[model samples]
Target chain A: MPERPGQAMQKSANKRRATVADVARQAGVSVATVSRVLNAKAGDRNPVAEETCQRVRQAMQTLGYRPSQVGRTLRTQVAHVVALLIPDATNAFYAAIAHATETALRERGYAMILCNTSEDPAIQDEYLREMQAHNVAAIVLLGAVETAELRTAANSDTPIVFLNRRAPQGVPGPFIGIDNAAAGEAVGEHFAERGWARIGCIRGPQTSPASRERFEGFQSALAAAGKPLDPDLVEQGALTIESGDAAMARLLAGGHRPDAVFCGNDLMAYGAHRRLADQGLSVADVALFGFDDNPLNAWLATWLSTVHVPHSQFGRAAAEVIVELANHRGERMERQILLPFHLEVRASA
Target chain B: MPERPGQAMQKSANKRRATVADVARQAGVSVATVSRVLNAKAGDRNPVAEETCQRVRQAMQTLGYRPSQVGRTLRTQVAHVVALLIPDATNAFYAAIAHATETALRERGYAMILCNTSEDPAIQDEYLREMQAHNVAAIVLLGAVETAELRTAANSDTPIVFLNRRAPQGVPGPFIGIDNAAAGEAVGEHFAERGWARIGCIRGPQTSPASRERFEGFQSALAAAGKPLDPDLVEQGALTIESGDAAMARLLAGGHRPDAVFCGNDLMAYGAHRRLADQGLSVADVALFGFDDNPLNAWLATWLSTVHVPHSQFGRAAAEVIVELANHRGERMERQILLPFHLEVRASA
Candidate 1:
């Protein structure tokens, strides 16, 4: 909307920083004219009036108007935007990662367009195309849902960074994930030390690479310790609290009850713990472990031992990689970024 | 990056959607030429080879290429992007709102740029100016922090929607908020139904208008019931679990023993519940209430009674209003939107 007579007075009354529009108003020029001067370049062919340019610059100085990188982004066509695709933001794990990524990108004067894909490959594909069409700087896929659309996006002109999940089968891209196998092995070893003879596990969705890797590495460690994981003790379900509760209920109804159980994520662990509590059992009787040590572990659900995936580190690294790739500054180094994880042994385990 | 040799072969191997660049390649024309043809106006004066336009159109048909709105955004200088300013996305309240807002905007072919300011006015200012310079379709401030920058942005050209908080000071803008004061009164009356004589309250940050409104409404209800709120029983703290815990601890240590307590949000109630549990007391003994009924109520923290604030409604309304205002359809009507709330009576109360 065009500014009215008293709008400038209202703006000044509110302490709004001067914008190009403000500069344009003072210089008696158009907003586009002001932008042209702000984004003036060497060897530029377009001829702008010298007097007009000086007036715009003088107006900027008088108003303390610091031009934003937006003009440059328009000149380049590609927006300073990174579309972050996460399965669900309601999950604290994704929320933390999104927060970190937003912080990192904002520091570089970039904006993050967050998408909640709901673990559906179709949703993921839709967002992927829209982001590409908008000429976003990059796309960060968190726990990417493997689809044919993703396979093509992997090799598109825009760069993609995968978190927790590796590149969709065979395509090469900048991938960021943790040493989940090692973390799982460590958890297995810690469980063995706790003297729990009958250990069970509640795995997340089988589609998730992280969940599969965690379970596989766990079995490897158990086998090495002369105690192969009992096949009857494992139950697979979605990564939700309800699924975890049902899985735990099934585990209890089975013939051989496990003394300790590990879940795919914290939500699953909470469900498992709640089920046990309802059954007049406690973490003291059946130890539990979960993944993704949410920041609120200490305040709520402190008993469930969990693995701390450095969400901030994941976000920062993803943002750094995206920015570099978007600017064409990264083409060789650090294609596969592997972060570390640690087990938080709480009272539950 | 330009498509390398055989990159098309790889792209074909995958199911990637064809972009404008692909159209340019198939037609053997410059990318700019393809864009010009895609964006041809009713009276385009630039003379171009009719054969070239036909070839470009044929390439688009062969590739099943659907031109995106990006070209229109470029021509108009206003991308279909909305800036959502949130205090923190990690909180389930804000996270839910963000998710809903994202969904609504996505349906409208717009993207949301989430900004987590952590209640800092300075950071909010930086993001405001940046969004303005980028010419975002609108700015949605969730629990807006009162700042001069905010006051100015309230009157800026770009549409601004205030949620949870009204416009800074006296500035006029569209707002989406629940009837918090009425919700508080409902909670107060409900507490009286539970036959709790000694009732206490824990408030959120003093800067938040919602918190103040909620408290004032609660006091009004209590006074009507001939049990005016006791100042000694009230504790003001931040909207954090730790703050909630500290406030509960202080209430417990006070001279009066309250049988029921109301908190600003569910997190605070969780903290209070945990504190009571730590002291070997259950909600059955000391009733508790909270606000913003998180979706995880039944699965986790089932005992903490709360008020159900319609976060999805807030997001949807904000999105609808912003879209209307940004597109210049909303000059008046429904400017101050007030959503509804309900009392969720859990075992805690």
Candidate 2:
């Protein structure tokens, strides 16, 4: 009988510690039988005769034996684990996605192991290798897979689903995310409708599919509207607050300042908002539009107009895809899941 | 040589693909040598000499031969992994911590496995067990250990360092975090000096040490000011925007609203800000204070007054401690480190 912490403390206080022998005696079973039952391994050993198993179980319950998970994991090959690789966990957008994904994973009896790649292709490969070594059942990649190395590694045996990212053509896997290109087009139309002609865009990293697709859609929309897309007005940044701040600062320093600014993500928009405010310009004064309708944007203080990615659904769908793949054992069709994105108009832009 | 995707596209436009042997033949290497190098096992075999190693490396680099991580993990016992378990990754505060921690861990040649526990003790325990099963070197637990089960499980052989959460007395390990009690006292003193008559506080989850310490410190400072602390004024919430909103709503509904509100964390403050705003109340109208000076709070839109928990330092220190423990396998040190916290007063409070 393994004494639980609560019972141990109580017994120590009362000087009535119960031993494994005592439990065995009470159950009319051998110490080994009692031990096996407490460890949840009775199912593996000769079915334990139902009456005896019942007695052993009752003994463990009365003795308050808390089975050690450490011991159990060592015996079981299935760790009930999965791995999630993302650009950064601290970004609220990614974090929200991770949080939702974790919740869904846990409900499905899977534990998630997370990796922060920081958009570095090398680091991403390293984490991928590590996750593989852990025998993670599946992987959910939340950022762009830049190098061919990552794609090839993922293609072999791992049931990978992309979250907030898209696999290139010929990559056999499911990608669960919003249509970045369409979202960008919507942003451009929103700006054009608002009569903001001279728009400056702070794009995300060029390597990311999201950044490229969004840029393509925005450019297409601007071209359709007969607006010349100024290459000078466009600047690339990593999807980060600091990067956004730096890009916005550089844009401000440049001689030509556009009336409206479209940021790749909401965090970047917030950064642009800060820079504008520091320059004695408020959000209302210099219209700012951002991608990812983060919950913070809805707050009165930051009322950031943005595009809303179905973050929770993206996560749920990704998990479902992975679970489906796991159950079918690689027999399911390769899915390209593109959830919808909403344009949320607020006070900022 | 493995044909480049571009060249392949140009050649066939639509073909299934060449095999690994074909790539080896093109690269001018034996099939076995190519297999060893592509599998990331060049160092293990003597069959491929140094010159051959370089040639294969260059060929794979040019040919873009990415080995499957799943196959490698199945063969090797070394996962080269560690887990960074956080309460909420989307919360900028936790996200920043996780990013820094991952960076530190990666630099040490360990892959970071991220787990968003959502402050759920059960989920936290499940993740911890999973990490152990995967043979992770160590675990860095961020935020609060919300369950007694997790607290006990943390005390096992698996090395764990609690980030931003204080362990119970005599836990026999170091807990790296800022002094929440002192931070709360600082907020109390700030409110006292500002001459706020009635002070309200939004505490975090009851299970968290941060909430208890902050509550204690706030109570002490208010007691020193001879201001009768109203039990009804304190509201409990999960460290989230929604929880903060709901708690504030409860506070207002209870009709025990104070002149100023001190939040356990920034997200909650942001949430409370939203509720107050929706109710047509300005932050300036009712003073607000928050903890964890997250990057978002520093934004011009937020400008929230907060207690700055050295975000990077928290992650760095925790990583340093775990790395130290891992290096000295036989040595044991029960250390308790308390980092400093600073108060940042902005336009909001």
- Interface RMSD score of each model: 9.7, 12.9
In lDDT terms, how accurate is model 1? 0.81
What is candidate 2's lDDT per residue for A14-62, written digit by digit as tens?
A: 2122456778898998977776665555247454667888987787679
- TM agreement with the true structure for every prediction: 0.84, 0.68
Q: Give one digit per residue, the lDDT tens place, for model 2 in B1-349.
A: 1111321111112222233566687679777777766655535645567787788777766655545333333344334567878877776777788778877776775667778776777777778766665556677777656466565545555566777786655554467777778788888888888888777889997777778899789889888977756888889888888999998898888875678899988889878888998889878777889888887665433578898888887766766777777765434445556777788898877
Classified by CAPRI criteria, candidate 2 counts as incorrect
- Kindly list the per-residue Cα lDDT of model 1 for residues A178-260, writing each as its tens digit: 87788888888888887799999999877777888888888898888888889899998787778889999999999777999
The C-alpha lDDT values of all candidates are: 0.81, 0.72
> Each prediction's Cα RMSD?
6.8, 9.7
Q: With candidate 1 superimposed using the best TM-score fit, by how many Å does residue A180's alpha carbon deviate from the native?
A: 1.5
Question: Candidate 2, A211: how far from true, in Å?
Answer: 2.7
